[model samples]
Target: MASFVIEGGHRLQGEIHPQGAKNEALQILCAVLLTPEKVTISNIPNIIDVNKLIFILGELGVKVHKIDESTYTFQADDIDLDYLESEKFKKDGSSLRGSIMIVGPLLARFGRGYIPRPGGDKIGRRRLDTHFEGFISLGAKFRYNKEERFYGVEAEQLHGTDMLLDEASVTGTANIIMAAVLAKGTTRIYNAACEPYIQQLSKMINSMGGNISGVGSNLLIIEGVESLGGCEHRVLPDMIEIGSWIGMAAMTKSELTIKDVSWNDLGQIPRVFQKLGINLERKGDDIYIPSQEEYEVQNYIDGSILTVADAPWPGFTPDLLSIVLVIATQAKGSVLIHQKMFESRLFFVDKLIDMGAKVILCDPHRATIIGLNHQSNLKATTMVSPDIRAGISLLIAALSAEGTSTIHNIEQIDRGYQNIVERLQAVGAKIKRVD
Candidate 1:
């Protein structure tokens, strides 16, 4: 465990570059198992979760070559299926939620996929029903060991079939798509998750000779192929991290320019911040945010309080609602944050409240935040980060508070963010990590 000691009430100015998408990297790494040829991937984020998955791949006997700090080439020409049954795998695979993704590629190529129930943030109920159900729909036999909390799927021969997912789960959609890509027939997946990560996976698979259509849409059509070959792919910059940087700039009133943001891929994130009265200017794929003394949150056109909620793609991402809630605490007007996806994600608002932000926790799924208008600065406090998104939100709050703030359990932050202390220090933020 580690803590972040921050000296607040300081303005920072500089350029920041977001790391490659963590969610995308998970799927892309697993896709390598579908091919025996070399697959090169660039812009890979060096974070705990992604690194853990890469280690698991290496343990499974994939030949990993480091091209540079941010790029790697993987060759899955030989795999040790026995590793899936090893005690070491039970421990390693269960530690990262992203490890669940390897199941799809394994089930497609080796006829068996096994993983101890994976773990990650303690946000809420993250069910694997969508994944197992989709596998079952694709003619895979499902098995679970209740005592060990382990799950497995097997298929002698996969035959694709059309399926309507119960929910548009991103990982679930990705897993099914990977498994379906190698099946014997065409698989049409409706109500699929079309997040940028999923679209990127589909595109990468297409370049590797997988026939996939209806990209960037909720309905995906995949015609099974015999085998996949290798192709080079570059991951997009993490959108969630980009949103957090935008929120930090507003809260600290810093003139920050984020480089290579891939503006069109940001969907509703920029507009969501704009609705909160944060100004964002695009200069040749870079996002330039000028310092503002105070920004006002916008109410509805009908003269009501604005409510921000999360939905599937083309909608505001649920991962950023915590940052949005924290940003609203300093705005001129009030806003309601409805976290429809996860029930426990809003629990960190208590830490915000203790720091002098006026917030009303409306049950487990919603909260109401009244703007402080910067008339009074938040008093410094000590808190513990419960999850990755909330951890970053608290870090933003700490940066804008009156005095020094201490945040413990920063391993959650490290799970998603890459070199956060160094990156912030480069941007003139007085932050340090206490190991």
Candidate 2:
């Protein structure tokens, strides 16, 4: 295991480029299995989860070649369909949640797909019912192997049908779209997830000869295609990382510029930070945050205390709520953070409270933070990273605290953010990774 020893109270300056979107990379990588032709992808984030997915593809006999540091070409011309039933595959596929997405493309092209019980951050109950249910709706036979804790889907030939998802589950929507693109008839998906990742996946599939309409809306229509061809795709910048940097600049009173942030796709993220009084300037495609002595949280129009909550896309992302909560510790006013999507994600506030932040854990899903208003610095402490988002949030808190802080189990952070220690160091953050 490794840890990050960070010296606090240093202001970071200069420009930092956000890595490619981690979530979108997962979807795009899985989509490669849908086509036999070489699909070149640029801006691939070199992170643990993505690498693990690539490793899984290699195990399945997909041809993967590295074109550059952030580019790769994948061809599924010689896939080993039987490899999905192997014991090694069960172990490898269970390592990341994104591995479950492969079932869609595999079932679409090969008529069968298998997956072990997937593993990821234990934030809350992330259900796979929506995914399997979508496959079932697309004329696939779904079965669960209780002994192996695996899921299997098979169809001689998938016939498209209408499906109204129980929720706008991102992975579920991606899985259904991948499967529907090759079905025999038209597939209509209502209440689908329309996040930037989903939109980009649709565009990439369309470019590869699939017909998908309503790329940026909840209703998606996919016409079955005989086969898809090769295409190049460049993923958008990581919005979660952009939001985290914004929070970091506000908490530490630093002047930082996040480059190539895909500003239009950021939706309400910037406005959400602005409500906390953080100053942001848009320079073409980049976001510049000026140094701040203090920032004040804004109240509602009716004079009630302000509340920041997570919703589906077009609202505040649940992924950045942890960062927002940590940033609020230094703001001038109080705000309630509701993590409506995940129950256990807000429990990390106990550690923040231990570090001198005034936080009331209303429940597993909500927290109310009373800002210090720069009155005092947070005292450093030893802590463990419970999950990816919480781990980065604690790292941010440690950077803005007094004295040195040690965060253990940072492998969780590496699973998402690429070269975090090195990237932060480039901007003058005093952090070191230790074995």
Candidate 3:
């Protein structure tokens, strides 16, 4: 295992170009199973999760070729669907939650889908009931053996139907969309997750001849198609990464400009940060973060303490709550951090507390952060990362601390951010990756 060692309190000042969306890349990669033609995707981030998905695709006998830097071509012309039941496949497949997405495509094209429980962040109870419910709604029969923790779905003739998802689960919605794209009739999915990642997937599907409407909204209508032909598409820049950089520059009082941020696609992230009193300058498509001595967190209109919460797409992203909470520690006022998505996400605040952050853990999902206003710089400390966002949060917290801060379990960080240390270093952050 590797760890990040950081000598904190260095103000970062530079320009950074966010990488392609990791979430979008993973979802798009699985779409290859829906076609036999060659699909070329550009601007793919070299991250752990994407690599694992590509590895799983290889196990399924999909021909994956690296054309050049940041480009890969996938062809599912010769697939081995039987490998879904292999021990090696199941073990590796269980390592990522995104692996569950393969079920929809596999079942639609191969008549069956099988895999053990998928794994990713241990933030909370990520349920697949919605995924199975969507499949069952599409006339697929599901069998789950709890003792073995394996799931199998089969539908003799998969037909599209109208469904209101039990919940707007990101991956569940994605799985359902993949299944619906190849079904018999038009599928109307209400209350769907139309996050930027999901919208990107929908666009990719549409480019392949699938008819999809209402993208970037909760309502999605998909018209089933007989076959999909491969198409080349470039991925959008990662908004989450851009948000992370915003938080990073805000915390360090650093002057930073992020290029190619796709300002139009950043649905409400800018406004959400504005509520936190973070000033961002948009010149063309670039976002500039001017250096500031201190910024106060704005309370609600009533002057009561504010609360920053997460919701589905067009709402604030739950994935960013961790980073927001950490950034709040340096602001001028107190705020409640409500993480509605996961139960265990707020537990890591204890580590932040140890580094001089004044936080009250309300429960597994909520915390209150009282800002220090840079009055007292946190002392460097050693900590272990809990999840992807939490890991990056801790790293950012470490960078603002006074002395040396060591963070273990960097694999979690690498799973999302591409060359984060290098990028941070480019901006004058004293961070290094060490084993």
Looking at candidate 2, the ten consecutive residues that score lowest on lDDT are 308-317
Candidate 3's C-alpha runs over 4 A off are none
Q: What TM-score would candidate 2 get against the native?
A: 0.99
Q: 1-435, model 1: which lDDT tens digit per residue?
A: 789999999999999999999989999999999999999999999999999999999999999999999999999999999999899999999999999999999999999999999999999999999999999999999999999998999999899999999999999999999999999999999999999999999999999999999999999999999999999999999999999999999999999999999998999999999999999899999999999999998898899999999998988999999999999999999999999999999999999999999999989999999999889888899999999999999999999999999999999999999999999999999999998
Q: What is the TM-score of each candidate against the true structure?
A: 0.99, 0.99, 0.98
For 1-435, candidate 2 gives per-residue lDDT tens digits of 999999998999999999999999999999999999999999999999999999999989999999899999999999998899999999999999999999999999999999999999999999999999999999999999999999999999999899999999999999999999999999999999999999999999999999999899999999999999999999999999999999999989999999999999999999999999999999999999999899989899998998999998877899999999999999999999999999999989988988999999999999999999979888899999999999999999999999999999999999999999999999999999999
Off by over 4 Å in 2: none
Residue 201, model 1: Cα distance from true site in angstroms = 0.3
Q: Which pairs clash (backbone N, Cα, C closer than 3 Å) in model 1? A: none
Count of backbone clashes, every candidate in sequence: 0, 0, 0
User: Which candidate's lDDT is highest?
Assistant: 1
Candidate 3 lDDT, 341-409, residue by residue in tens: 889888889899999999999888789999999998787999999889999999999988999999999
